[model samples]
Target chain A: MKETSLQNGLVERYIREVGRRLPQKQRDDVETELRSLILDALEARGDAVVDETPEEAQVAVLKELGAPEEVAGRYAAAPRYVIGPRLYDAYVRVVGIVLGAVALALVISTVINLFQTQPEGISILVTVGEFILQYISAAASALGFTTIIFVVLERTLSEEDLKDLKDETEWDPRTLPHVEDHDRIQPVGMVVNICLTILAIVLFNLFVDRLGIVFMQTEEGWRTIPMLSETALKTYLPLWNISWVMALALNIAVLQQRRWSTATRILELGVKVFTIYVLARMLAGPVPWLPFSSWAGDGMQIVESLLTQVFRWAMVFGIIGTVVEIGQSIYRMIRQR
Target chain B: MDEIINNLILELRRGTLMLSVLSQLRERQYGYSLKERLAEQGMDIDQGTLYPLLRRLEKQGLLSSEWDVSEARPRRYYVLSASGQEVLAAMITEWQQLVKVMEHLLPQA
Candidate 1:
């Protein structure tokens, strides 16, 4: 009885492996059929007992049937891939560009850090170690995000649309665009926006304290001055979160559609409007700064006022940028009509 | 050269597999029995390929199946549907013509 149960267990485990890979709807039916077929195959061997087949014999039979994934692939009607051939080229290109950009940024930042701090000996080794760690994390994140975007594209893009993209005869070089076509959607740029928006959402919501200017001093070591007013952040965070999330969805939509449509343009306008509201609220309210009494010293007041002035100018520029975006969205909508 | 020949052979057999499967399903047989029957007739097909092909053909309405719970293990039996017979007849005619063409085109081996 124990031997029979053990043999059945082995068979059941193999069936479950194959069923896991199959779609939910077909899973039960396939598993039932597979169980029956496997038992029949085992029975076909003359020396095999009816119920108590040896482990070696069962293993041989299952091995002959093939690996669970291979068997499941044969069962599945649809082509299986995380990112299919249709989007594979674009996926590779985007990953290459992102990693390259990440490498370049790391090199540039490291150069700037070295110049600013002028680290020596052990500190120089520490800098190099930091660069290596940053590069690895950044490259990994870039690859992860790029792959996720391509996987989404693969799922959302219809076979007909992908075929149309590949149809070179339909795409003429002359008809591509004369000047900088504002109607054209850039996929890489949208992906970058998505990554940055995600990072911003995480930073502003979870790690708000990290957003500040850091000062490196020999006497007191590193000190950071908090830039955002607690009251301002509390009032405007919800609005900021909403706009960021909306922008993320809009960028993904544009990436999928591969063009700027009237609908997306309208959505973009809505997000910009929200951003403008947030910016306007910040500008009208108290200066977005915490108390500067934490680390007071010589030239501290000058630095504080200068930073406040910079924040005001930044808010002004932000509002202007948002207004320009709204104008562009409206112009596109009209032109589309 | 051997690999190329093997690949060509596989490609040649790919279409014929469906026809062979369809021809066998004229009578009711369960998955294992059908696999055994095909292998006996010198067409060796693995269980993985054969089982999925049966399900696909059944899905396409060329074959119909039912579970026979009377057996110790409930076995799903498959047979040609009305449309399946008609398709098989048409496919046989096409196959004969193709064989004739091939015989004429190929050098005497």
Candidate 2:
């Protein structure tokens, strides 16, 4: 009897610990159920004599029962979320779409500036385009950020109502499903598509007109006709034009295939650095040897300076955005593991 | 194996816990004593799990508890509220029907 009492006491303490984490309303029922389970487990062991030392029995019972935290976690419902699983996934999807759209818009406006004949007009266009791109990107990011806040709030509120629901639903361990190996192809495919589209646009602008595609011009420099200006096409061009696309694509592909291997990540960083260098070169073009001649000859010097400044700022922002996205992807990969 | 037994036990608990708890509270009993009594009936309940259920039922106005300081060990005694009694009656009826259905399916010894 003394041995039984000791075993019972250990069981009681175990139950109490598990109960403390549970909501106040469902505490009693869950406690009762868990206590019965402990008793059942003890009975099944069947090793101890009735008169054995209580402490010894308790030690035996507890060892067999497993850790209190692990057992309690088993009984807990799938963890309540502020945003439900469905909503969280939806939120991520919507945010991705919004960012993609904003990027596309910025790319389109940049391409338009490249085509304008009037130097003064080009300067104004670049400034206006830069302002619009900044505003839209900020708005989209803010919208995405709000989804996280909403998820947190929803979880807190729902937890209150769900406290009493403990015994109604059977506890099942929640496990994230294994991500298939094939899923690695998605980011790689997106990167490749983006890069190819950009290259195609640049090549089309550069070679298409000389080859007789009327709207495209390659004579002085690669430029596209204003009428052919579409947001998707423009955004695709400047975005994929830089070396970052190759680096980002390779990194994402390697990261996906190899998980968090240090060598792959280092290579990714190298590619990013090289891409930045290329971007800087594109932003800061060759300095004019004869500024006065160019300024007086066609009055295009002022226009060129303004366009260069706008492009420089855009490239700087693009680099910042790319770095941020890379950092986020790396963090996500680690966390997902 | 233990896994199968645990799953079966968990399912049984999910279906009948509310009724078992409600029936026990028809008479006034404090949390600790109620748990002890249930254990004697081979339904050992952990205090960790029980306290929360009691509070929830109380919040829902299904059960009422009051601090009883009559004994040296002053404790809170809980009794079934009218609404709780009604719910318990409904749950008991549903359980009886379920038992009857299962009994019909089982072969007699």
Candidate 3:
């Protein structure tokens, strides 16, 4: 039977509308499927059946099935992982590396702290050093726990039947809708990071001043002062903290972009590691000045001991923070992929 | 009596529509031929509905289709994909069990 212009127009329009929503790889497949359905309906009604025009019948069938948009949506309703599988696998591998590094740092620092001693029978430096080591240990344990939970949830809760559906839905780079400038959330994330970093710095300074006398009585004495020095503070404190703030901002930007890339995700991770390193150096007293040698007189030995222990603990915290941050970044990157 | 019998038949077939479609698709058939065959078997499905269902099943990886353009008129022929075959095998096992249960429950013929 000769196809009428009206019937042809209806089929063409329907196919085009539906096809536009589908990925190019699957577009032809969907069109063929849709065409067969229309033809099948016409054939079932019979070639000689003349109650309704082909155009009218086609339109009626399309209407009952709903709009092309709605029909397309049903076929495309497959679940999307926030982090693609490849990224998730990468994240797990990277996090494992981070956790291992942190654990090693913790063990090494703990052993070193055990051997180090103070002049006075009970030195506050050792106490502080022990406290920081404990803190790192605790933080690492918490992160390890959380990662395990999330991984378990990902494996157990994910739908097994929808595996193919997940694979079929390709991440089309072109069709990824452009994010509007105003909709960007990076600025907000950076602002929050800066605010938090500032708060942390202020707290660190206050803690140092409160414990200044004790630090001075230790073997390393003036070395602990760099942790509170405004210049060293500015140099070391903000590096990774700023990077963290920026990483968070970039993550927000990525979210706004609506398309995930491994490059942006890795950059975000790099910033997180840099931030942790900066914080570690700040806590350990920036190396160039040899801040430990300046303290003098009768209390030099005590001050030296105190500063040494404090620096050691700071190193421990820094090491732990670096690992945790790396783990977090790797997890997020993999999850996003 | 005829109306009641028809409605019961529909309900019975409705539950087994997917299985019926899979069973028939052991041999390759296009959308039009599939609908005709089903109609001949007394399950008269609307073309609009069957086609979409077939597409959905194909998308789900239960069926696969390819166009046969060697003939003057090109037709899209669908058959059970590997995954579809596996699912069908499982479904048949369940169906046999169901049939045995029904046979035991029904009054002696």
Candidate 3 ranges with C-alpha deviation above 4 Å = A4-8, A43-48, A64-66, A80-337, B1-15, B44-49, B52-62, B81-83, B102-109
lDDT of 3 by residue, B1-109 (tens): 9999999987887788889889899899988789879989988775545666787789789999888888645688999999999999999999999999999999878
Could you tell me the TM-score of candidate 2?
0.42
Clashes counted in candidate 1 amount to 0
DockQ of 3: 0.16
The ten-residue window of minimal lDDT in model 1 chain A covers A1-10
Candidate 2 chain A has its poorest 10 consecutive residues by lDDT at: A286-295
- Tell me the DockQ of each model, to 2 decimals: 0.55, 0.07, 0.16
- Estimate, for each residue in A99-162, the C-alpha lDDT of model 1 and write its tens digit: 9999999878886676557553356456767887999999999899888888778778877888
lDDT of each: 0.82, 0.61, 0.66
Q: How much is the TM-score of the A chain of model 1?
A: 0.43
Candidate 2 lDDT for residue A288: 18
Per-candidate TM vs. native?
A: 0.47, 0.42, 0.37
Better of 2 and 3 by DockQ: 3
True contacts kept of each: 0.62, 0.00, 0.28
